[model samples]
Target chain A: MATTMITTLDRSSRAAARGLSDISIRNLFIIPTILFLIVFNIFPLIYSLGYSFTDFRASTSAAANFVGLQNYRDLLSDPYVWSNFAITAKYVIISVAGQLLVGFGVAMLLNRDIPLKGLLTTLLLLPMMLSMAVVGLFWKLLYDPSFGIINYALGLGTFEWLSNPKMALYAVALTDIWMWSPFVMLLSLAGLSAVPKHLYEAAAIDRAGPFYTFFRITLPLVAPILMIAVIFRTMEAFKTFDLAYILTSQPTAELISIRLYKMAFQEWQTGRSCALAYIVLIMVLAITNIYVKYLNKVKER
Target chain B: MRKTMTSLLAGIGLVLACGTSVYAQEKELTIFWAEWDPANYLQELGNEYEKETGVKITVETTPWPDFQTKAFTEFNAHGDAYDMVVGDSQWLGAGSTGGHYVDLTDFFNKHKVGEVMAPATVKYYAEYPGGSSKYWAIPLEGDAVGWSYRKDWFEDPKEKEAFKAKYGYDLDVPKDWKALRDIAEFFHRPDQKKYGIAIYTDNSYDAMAMGFENALFSFGGELGDYKTYKVDGFINSDKAIAALDAYKELYKFTPPGWAKSFFVEDNQAITENLAAMSMNYFAFFPSLINEASNPNAKNTGFFANPPGPNGDQFAALGGQGISIVSYSQKQEEATKFLEWFIKDETQKKWAALGGYTCSAAVLKSPEFQNATPYNKAFYETMFKVKDFWAVPEYAELLQQLNQRIYPYMIGGEGTAKETLDALAADWNATFKKYGRGQ
Candidate 1:
């Protein structure tokens, strides 16, 4: 009966394909959108790749000329660029790790049948809903040495959280974690809610504890969703800029995005900045690829 | 029913036609500017100008980081984003290319903006590459860097006697780096209840470079060559090293975590009366003279940056200059506004407004000087202020220097001479990169 149903569906799909092939104008409607993408997105990427081989400056069009691999060579020896990358790495790792850990713990706490769970979850997600600039500015004021509530509460003598080079990155990372942890928590909560009650019931009947069931069934079942969440959040964390840029007093807390922005806009080194952006893109793509591979493995299990 | 619908359609068409005509009649001018005191003041003056001329001026305030980038992008894209721009003096070189800025030589000559303004102000803004013609921007504000100290502390009889006994010099306002150092050291007592001075030592490019620029220039060393950037011995010469070393010595008298102080901290230090002397722009001192924030308002005093061995004091001028954008749709209206804006009358209004000290003309105005007792000193100090790295790539070059020099000065990593020498060597490449011949 199943084989007969599959054959019928295959035949219908074949007939549908034939009918679709005859419709010309219907297919041509997408041509304009494809053209737009080619012009705006693909063309710029190709042009930037070409310009990366030249002395391309955004400010002076006349100054740009072909100089193969010179910018890349310069970047290799550039201490400032390397230092920026180091700072960016520090910002991304610390922020992503902190967000995931805190988010998972909070999600676990919120998933339990507790009083005011709905209201508590809504309140927890407030930071995630705020615009990045508002979040940045708010945190900037909060981190203010004299009048800030953070220093007032810490009573740790009002540190220059965003001004001091030693603490600027951490301060920026702290704000990002605060703003984005809720996002991870919401995703995890969705995964947790979707877990079947039968698994827990069966485990309880077998004399399994809550911790044992969580490890053996709940964890394995939610692994795929949690991995996807982590991959998405990590990618977002890598591109962070507004919080670091607005909250920090200087570029000491600058991320890859901030540095790329400064290079393109501030220094007018459009080609170099584009090249750096592409490098970040490649890095993120590789990370996503590895994550997807790991996720597929989990799904297969 | 058909007749009623037809009449309603005709009425709607008539209203649309009338709206278009009315919009056409109201000339709208958009101006983009970085956040500056005069820029904000001009937004208010724009209404007054519009009321007089019947031309509406729409003011858009762009943050400092995005101002140049956005303006240049819009200009290159051929977008009519602004009628005029509040530009920096150093950016004039980039703005003048391809007529990015309107050539105001003839306009200024006709309006006598150069003749009417002070000499220093004219030299800074009115004179472009060739002193003869095609000047790019009008000097909207003039900023001069200087040292401000607490007269209450310096003038106290007991403290004065103690300082004289310790340093063998009268406790008066410092005249040069030597005296300033002596005073900073005297005030620096970590075990005591008070600290002496506040120096901004952040490793970021601008703070470090600008700070170094003010001190190096005061010690008689140039940042780079006239037209291009070049790092020569002058950047790390004996004089420059001496300045950096002196900065380190001065840091000894500063509070703990002195390396982290920027303008905000410096402002806090002076405002809260935690520090005695602070390096800052002259505009910052007006608050110290005001009675509301300061009970000892009369006790605040201003001095020119301490002189070098040559007895000449200098400062880094950072005032924002105003220029008409090349891609402005309403050039005529913008020029008319600019012409009126730079007039002695308008300039006097700007300086008297109190947030900004208009470069030379308004500050030098007797009326402006008489507006407040503190205005006179600030205006007098503007005469001695000079700008650092007026080259196109000034921002990048400054960053390069600061990345190397700041740590050394703050005692973070290396010797002052070693760091200065390293900066000097790296600066050569920077100068060459910017087409400045060594």
Candidate 2:
């Protein structure tokens, strides 16, 4: 009896040790990822937040002083800052709207049984795969007033596409649409293909007209996915800098991100730029929140 | 087996330790410069320096737009990454005042550097604030904006006769802005796929500032009172307005998108035979001469910037200086490198390797005069050079001009007077912020 009791005690002690070891292993697995995020992302975000309330220049070694909310007050009262925001909003609207229309139209056409459909879809997606810097440079050459193939093909005589202030913003928006519409189209194609064929059959048996059937059946089902694409693109469009900066130097087309870049690096206003970045982040978050609410409402319906 | 393995490991460790000791004995230095043709020459020179001395030297390059930010960031962080830097002339003020660069005044006096370099370069590029006694850098590249035109077109007797008959003046090198305008108008032929001139008004880089400052200064406008930093009456003066108006009027004869053209596009227009004339840095003359199949090079003629309406002539200074970083741990080695680089023999080699040297002896030599078609003009223009603010707040002041003045000149945003007035107001605010206002 004594031997058996001793053996049982030893077995219980081994099980306890295994339990403790399992807990330690679980902690080890998660610690490094959490540490990385804390070091790189969280720390910088907090550091920048603290800097937003100070007068700091990244190009000098002087210590930064807390200036209360002066940076925010100055930025909010500045007309130039507001003008940049206005330009960004307009760009986002135009670019996102164009992408939606072209993307949906292309997705609808491709939904049919066309020959070489897979290859055509892949080729159409090529622009989105390119780096933004490369795309900006390619489009700049295409928009060159003297030797660009674009004006040549259109038979327009000496049209300054990028130099003209009235046309520059539109030119940049057109380039963005050309690059990102493919992304929207790919997402939309997946949504369109997922639609049940039985629903279309039911509509046909009811002898419904094409327009009516699309309005009642197809439109509502795709609305959720379309909303998701719009939200993603709206955020991306608001942060555009490369295309607008490289293709044109017109101040009227200056987006907020470009302004932030100039303030941070060119002017060395690190504190002010951090505050500006936070303001932009908050604005984007508020917009995305509204979008998410609409998406939730669509799902409920 | 275990004993044999231990012996092998110990031998390997001994070899590594000896190798590391040898490496530690050799001093290493790094130099940072913008990515351009000059950088390649600097790298070649670095390799030679390494061979001569037992020290290893590495050349780091970044593109123009990113160079300032990258260099300043390293300085601000007190990083020991760069022993020396080829900094823009405008950076002298900030670099010296912020203690980013070592004060080179003692070094200059010790080395008698003034005897070797041009006086104008020393005054404008090396001095901290215009004519300050404190020196922070050594002028390395002496450059200015020089004008070049298609020699073939000017030499064509038929075209010359047509130009003379139409404009009632002989078709030759323009002597003033008015004559230049007339020539531009004569050569503008959109239907025949030709353009008159290539001048930049783009705010994308330094092109707008460098291209337009000379005209503004020649018209009797001042950026500000150097001592007091007062700009209200200077930048927005009547002469300044007239100069801007004249600059805008030339848009009619330029390529369709001339407002967007920078150095690359301007060079392309000249090389591709799309433009009849171009204005760019003298440093690019060597490249223009070597362009393959370029007819303009065979017949190219160079001139200083055309005189203004008031008969004042000036060209924008376009070059930089070399300075040792204040935080460099290899200061002794870097100073040795600079001493070697400024020698007469080294400068001769530098010029031969396609580098623009500010050495007085090299520039005054007959070899430099006949170096290229534009070499003589380059020498003359360097003497007539004027520069913009070289203050710590230069970037802020320049931002205002880029935002306000360029849009008016190129984008038709507002009247020139209004643009200048707004720019002056912005300048006043920046000065006030820095406690430098009148």
Candidate 3:
């Protein structure tokens, strides 16, 4: 009786209210968001797109002149820029592969009924929650050649991790993996939980081996979410800057993002940095297209 | 009618100037500087300034690693966040050309800054184009590359005999680069875990470049002509190659895994008893001199950059000049602060408070020279300082040098001649891109 009275009163109130119609109210909510995006995001995108065609120095108040693809041409032909791209690719592959293996392996262990499961999972996830810069600093101390715990613990005896040009990139990728693996683990865990118990019971009754059951049932079921996690991680790993920057200064660890940062901010080559950014963006989009196709295949299965 | 119009315009101009001066008397003023001991001392001076004047003065600082980035970000945005910046000498080119700093040519002459400060300091730190009347900054912190050594080991009779027997020299402070190398080799005993000198090898920013500049200047090599910005043949000259070879030779005797060591690591090598000698800035020598901060303080001795083969000595200029930001609204008040700051009495107090003052009056005083073990060396270094290009494109030049020089210097990526050739080409291309090269 009370609900009916409230519904009756709300209908009467709406009829009496003339401040805004439903369409107007909807627009009121949506228009500000559209305006905000246009002002903050779209405007910068358009502005930078224009700048990418010019010779602009942000540090100076001089007028920019249009160079008409000169920045792009120069970057495309630059050997050091190519080297940076190659370094970035190596870092992504190493970091993403490591993250997937470690994350899925841990998730497999946690999928089973375990003691203090929540606490164990929380502790494992701690590294992912910490600031990347902070983690890099701690790792630097750990990797120090003299009196570092890693050298002492493993008897590597003063192995240079960050300073060694041959090992610096891999060392940085390893730190990236250590920090991000738990993200993949969490996604994998969710997928594992969602796998129906009846399907496992069905496989057990059929006398399917553990490997067979996992391959036929678990693997196919979790593939979509696994692909999603991979897509997210690969994109982020491609643009990794903080870990690589803070952990090492070796040329081997100079990823493209770091180059972009140096160009845009340090070198103050605003126009060229914008052009190079567009190049990275195009590459990211191409990779995303390939990932999306794979995701579609997983969905079809 | 013409006189009436001129008088009317003059009256308006005078009123606008008065209006700006009135606006400049703001309640507070802020300075941007790197978070170092000098900045702290500057803050103490700021406190004194606050007491003298009604306006509050705040010294905002960032760590050395990100100081340039922070300053440039603010400058790029044309922000009025800082009234003054105690910025690196190299930044004058960018700061002046970009209009980040107010041109102080007239003010400099009016205040007679060049007449009172060290001539080299005025050349490297204040004047953007060496020997020019144009000025954008005041030589504030006068610094140069200096060294500290293990004095206890040097004084050991057995070590002295062994050094004299092996290298035909006494185990004392080296007077030249050749003797320095000899001393380094004498102490480079790997099995005993004691290494040679520690120097800048960190690839980031200007560490390695600054380290190499010591050798470069000593051997009488130049990167290029600063005026013309021409770098093709000069950087690849025989003398430059030899200087680079000398630096790499010195690197061979350093402690293992020092491919990325900088001042902090150099200091650690001395305090941790791992190195016999170390090169660092005079700004950082106080830590090694403080017996509480450094365990090896009592056994440490300081020296300036030694002479080269021809008895020519020059150290990389590693100091900052204070400049007023063009965007700042408190220019009048900032000018007042700087005017008071450069006074003889003020600079004396600055030195007393551990702020490195470039004032000729203070540095020449016997009392100031004897105040610290490194003071005399610092005084000597001030006269023989040289700086890199202070062009607006210096970041590009410095970064390129760092990227090319590091792998070769630390890792032996290529021959010195080849490395220098590659750098010369890189620099030539860079200069052309900036439209400075012929």
Candidate 4:
């Protein structure tokens, strides 16, 4: 009786597949997703690329005219744009360097057998989980000269952090490191925990120094994943906007993304801002490509 | 047959009644504005409107930092999230040019919105395109940058004698810009944790520009030709340079950490008694004047902006106007709401609730001038206040002003003349992009 039932079910399934071919079934399942991506993602990118060549302002009803790369030329030639780029690069270097040092160091400390490891990791990860705007705002209050806890604890006696143009960019970078170091630590922890125990045993037996052992064994194994973290963070820092915008308005702190935002939304120079965005995208992609190539090289070794 | 006809008439009457009830239920409105003291009062006034007319009012507000971005985002999308908006005065230029606001010229005139409000408010907050007679908004609130000071300290005999001995004059409300600086310098004692003044230094928006304009107008300098949009000679004139220098000099006397201060910081400087005087918008004075909120409310007094060397005085305008959004589907209802809002009785209630109404009757009345300590100063400043360029290119102009002035004011980057020359060049370039100048 069971055999008869199994045969009957198999016959019904075969009957259902009789009309539709495998290719048709696959298309039925995949067409909607492909259409969604093309419509929402690709279309806007192409449309904006078209606008980058025009003199269109989103704020006005004036008709767009084909300026034929005038926006790109103007952006490239502008000294102010270059300054914004330089500021962003400085911010990325400081913020990413701080994150790498703090995050890797924390991961190394946590790699040992420890109590409350899950809870400890969760507490450290809280900063990265909160909204960027919220974090920026809280840090702003923390950096306030008159009432902030930072001044109170350090006994700096009304020392200016965000208000000082020379220090404002670094102040924001410090906050960025505070907020994002946990992200790197989480990734680094995953890589740290995966290393074989026998290597450490061998290094211990050989009396290899901590630094030498790290440089030779642990680093080689973790370098590929670490590169992945660096690539993601570098790209993100290049596109930083809300945190910098909320924390400081000093021209010294203005990143390229903030400049792009001012042009697109504040000044309503839609076409020019689009051109600026393309420039940033190309730069980020180029840098990311280099990092990815190095990451594959490490993986091969 | 007669019974059937009677029943049919009864059914039709019931259907009509149901439709009327549904219409009343749908009479809802939303007005977008910056989150501030006035927005709270506006909500209270809106509650009264709802009570009287059965039309529910929803007041949506965002923080001042992102208010402009929020409004522009909605306008760019042409969304109907708000039926009306209490937008900044300078926004009239962009709103009308971009067709974001309804053409309210006929309604404004028909309702006599101009005749009922102060003349300056009507001109600055309502009209666009200079003398073209186009109106986009109704003057909802009136404000200006005015001075607030420690009245108790000024009245003290010891302080008076000390100030007089040092400045060689009576220690009283400043009569001119020189006296103002003198008073600031007198009160400046950083060792005691007591500073002289709190002024706008924030580079985020128009804070620094507005603070500097007070000196510029009084010093007999202009931003440029308001009619023809010229900037080179006027903006970088010797007098303009003097005004820029004067503002920078005042920044020296403020508390050490006020380099990025604005209205909120200025208010804190006063309430915390950290400064002897501060500059802030009159719209924010209600909190400073309310005894419940501020411990030194009674001791804090208001004063008009001081005159310059030539005895010329003008305050920077800080107000907004109400307009029906063009994308709203409830235009007629929103129009009805405005007609009711600008009435004498409603405006009186608005002022009583701490909402600064532009109604001449409400502002000039003895009860209003004497209502709060700051009310009288607000009334006086409204008449003499000067507004920035309310042209279609205001955003670009402000962005450039912030960049040029911030470095010099905060970072102490260059000489005053050099900074002004760079600002003039920036303005010229912006205007040139708009096909206005060579």
Interface C-alpha root-mean-square deviation, candidates in order = 4.1, 1.4, 1.3, 1.5
**Model 2 per-residue lDDT at B79:** 84
After superposition, which runs of candidate 3 have C-alpha atoms over 4 Å from their true positions?
Answer: A1-21, B1-25
Q: List the residue pairs that clash in candidate 2.
A: none
- Model 4 lDDT tens row, B1-438: 597799999999999999778556578999999999899899999999999988999899999978988998899889988999999988888899988999999998799888899988998889997667789999998989999999997899999999888878999999999998999999999888889999999877789889999999888889998778899889899999999999998999998777778998899888998999999999888889778877899999989899899988899999999999999989999999999998999999999988888999999999999998888888988888888888777988998888888899889999999999998988988888888745
User: Model 3 misses residue A101 by how many Å?
Assistant: 0.5
What DockQ would you assign to candidate 4?
0.55
Q: Write the per-residue lDDT of candidate 2 for residues B146-259, one digit (tens) a residue.
A: 787888888899999999899898999888888888888888898888888888777855778887776787777777887788898998999888887877777777878877
lDDT of 1 by residue, B335-435 (tens): 88887887666665666565454545556568777776556656766677666555556556666666677655643677777887787777777666756
Candidate 1 pairs with clashing backbones = B142-B359, B228-B436, B229-B431
TM-score chain B for all models. Answer: 0.86, 0.92, 0.93, 0.93
A254-296: candidate 3 lDDT, tens digit per residue = 9999999999888889999999999999999999899999999
The TM-score measured for candidate 3 stands at 0.93
Query: Lowest-lDDT window of 10 residues in candidate 3 chain B?
Result: B19-28
Q: Model 2 misses residue B416 by how many Å?
A: 1.3
lDDT tens per residue, model 2, A187-259: 8998899899999999999999999988898888888999999999999999998888888778879899999
Better of 1 and 2 by DockQ: 2
lDDT, candidate 3, B1-438, per-residue tens? 597799999999999999788557567889999998999999999999999887788999999989998999999999898999999998988999899999999989998998999999999888877657799999999999989999999999999999999988677899899999999988999888899889898877888889999999998888899888877667888888988999999998898778778888999999999999999999998889898889989999999999888888999989999999999988999999999999999999999999889999899999999999999999999999888888888888888898788889766798999999989988998888878848
